[model samples]
Target: MREDFLHYVWQQQYFDKQNLLTETGELLTVLHPGFHNTDAGPDFLNARLQLGEVEWNGAVEIHLRASDWHRHQHQTDARYDQVILHVVLTADQPVLRTDGTPIPTLALAGRIPLEMLHTYQQLQTAPPATLPCAPFLTKIPEITRLSMVDRALLERMERKSATVQLLHQQLDNDWEATAWHVLAAGFGFRKNTEPLARLAKALPLRILRRHRHNLLQTEALLFGQAGFLSAANEKAEDIADEYVQMLRAEYEFLRHKYDLENTGLKEHEWNFLRMRPANFPTARLAQLAALLHARPLLFDALLSAQNVAVLEQFFSNESSVYWRTHYRPGRAGKVPALGRSSMHLLITNVVVPLRVAYARSVGQTEQVEAALQLLTELPAEKNHVLALYEGLPFTHRTAADSQGLLMLATAYCQPLRCVECAIGSRILRHNSALK
Candidate 1:
């Protein structure tokens, strides 16, 4: 009933060609149905047909009604001049092209088999997939799977690079190393990300450079300012012993100066559930703060990191002495170890972005190549996109191929418009050939 169904039937050869006749019962022969152009003009292009032994070679156009030629304004356009045939579902009125010559018309309503219509209707009414190509992925080749996986890992790095570029804009292009650390710290999300970022942002490089000798005091100041003290909240001591008061005064001054409001940050209500003490944001920040206190030039080393292995090494041995013994000040939870997600975050936010930004800062932008190479060090993610590829014969083992799978999943497989996919066309054609 729909015009698209007519197009499908025409393109799929759903009608019998033998013993074909015109409405007036003249013998008809189709030489070429013509190319089905999706754009404007005739529905089919450059057709060759024979009507009553006079071979006609021109374009073919289709419509629901023979009068659509006028309805669509083809009569006013010269592009319809070559239209030799106007095939319609019903021939209600004689149609003509711009030249005023009558185009040979055929009503296809009576020519196509009822069985073909039923088959097409049933096929179109089938269920859709959650992941576009979920149903048909099993038919894909294994080699295609690997290619898609590798692409996904690279896709993550590319996304990380984009995120870093935004941070540069935020920091006014001031501190690439500090910006990378802040953004990388942000990925800890609502769970522990806020306090960590606050600790890093609060302690400026100028302060660290001024009191590089008092590393523990600097660490205690950063940690204390974040309200991480476990020595009870009832003390009213000097500015030095009153770590909370000193840090609070500093943070309040900074907040007003920077026009900032606290975000996802709380002294209490931290996520201790399913988290080890060492991995706790409070503990990690305290540890990182101490390490920064001890080695004021650590950011410089990170800026000079050459590869993923080097970056991994920096993160691997980056913990402080306090983190080794304590998880929290008041709480006596067991110390927890850092996980792989943290490592992934370090590579994505710190290592990759810092490299790209550092390269652009000094006019050596070739670091993009090195950044992308380091991204290949990680494995591809396992998400819905990968699940779709799993349905195919493809066995995804790399990040790049997983990204390709995501591209394929979003654009093709997940939509359930299988007939529109290249693989669907192949499957349909193969089935028809077998039949």
Candidate 2:
């Protein structure tokens, strides 16, 4: 069928290798199968084979049909000149190399093992309405399942940390606030993550580094950058005044820096229906910016600092005093308070990923456990990743696994590549015989 299936068969040597023959009735002896090249040019590179009494060394290419060589236009390319063999499922035409020399052809349809063929056919077939191997996976040893999950978790962490390293590279190694931005984006959860991360990415860390003392200005810049300067329509004069001058300066500076058309707020489209001010992008960014400005080197302290008491002491009263009573610029709200949600967000997204990233940079596994413990000190998170796994019976629910799940979802699950997932792959293989 597909060339990938043929590749799987050939690469695995599922076909009979003991005795082989060419379509021209010449006895073929295999010396090498060649390297499977995923890059440009031939399918397989540098093969060695014996054609009857003659021995040759070159490349091997495969096709579903012999006529595919010309169909794919490889005959005009000099790259196919070195192809010593052309293995196909069907030989419909005589294939010639770029030099007009006849290329050796081998049809593998009758040469492959019947048992392997049957197994492959059965595994790839349409299921009988149910999943392929549900009963069998349940019978697998619990230890194996646990080991597999653990491996998956570690693999996920390693992969996520690579992203951190790339971000650190982009930031020129101000790993501290990069961690904060990452965690802050996670705070909005999936619905608003991209927008939040965009705010973080758009607002440079240099701005935070410079005005790390003025929390209001910090928030103003962050919030204003996200197109949230709506002080004109606000009912509270004090709230409007708080950001008026800062918003003016921000607009002027932003116009020069970003070269934008308009920075003025359009009052009609702004939505403040049921969302509390603390959750509003304006108030939250301001509060978060204030917090970051208050503690510029917070990430460094978080990494080395072991105790939860220490972190709490550093972050407990870190939000803007205004945020305690107001969620937006001027809605007259008193119920809002800087919740542990942000703290937990910082820990889960920034601190944990940073530690994991640092661990990878230094090749230390201990930081993973340390990062996990830090997240556990905070409350449990509610995200798409956690929600998906919430219904599944998990024996281990450590912060490490939670962080791993976050990485897994953001990195893998959300994109729907479950087939490549350990659990999904395991489930697939378990049902392979019944497919």
Best by TM-score: 2
**Model 1: lDDT to the true structure:** 0.60
Compose the digit string of candidate 2's lDDT tens values, residues 50-147. 99999999999899999999999989999999999999989898899888999999998876656555534543452543222233346555665565
Reference-based lDDT, residue 432, model 2: 39
User: Each prediction's Cα RMSD?
Assistant: 9.1, 5.6
Q: In model 2, which runs have C-alpha deviations exceeding 4 angstroms?
A: 29-36, 46-50, 53-58, 110-136, 139-155, 172-184, 230-279, 302-318, 334-349, 355-396, 399-435
Please provide, for model 1 over 1-435, each residue's C-alpha lDDT reduced to its tens digit, 9 standing for 90 to 100: 557656755666656677877766777888878889888877888778899989988888888998877888999899888887777889999876666887777788866766555444444554554443344446655444454444444455556556666666666766634553554365354476655655556555555555546655555455555555433453443334444454455545544554444432345645667865556766666545544555556556666777667766665533444455556543434554445666665665566666666566567767766765665676766865466455446545544445556655664455444455455444444334222
Candidate 1 backbone overlaps, count: 32
Strongest candidate by lDDT? 2
Candidate 2: C-alpha lDDT: 0.65
> What are the TM-scores, per candidate, against the unseen true structure?
0.53, 0.69
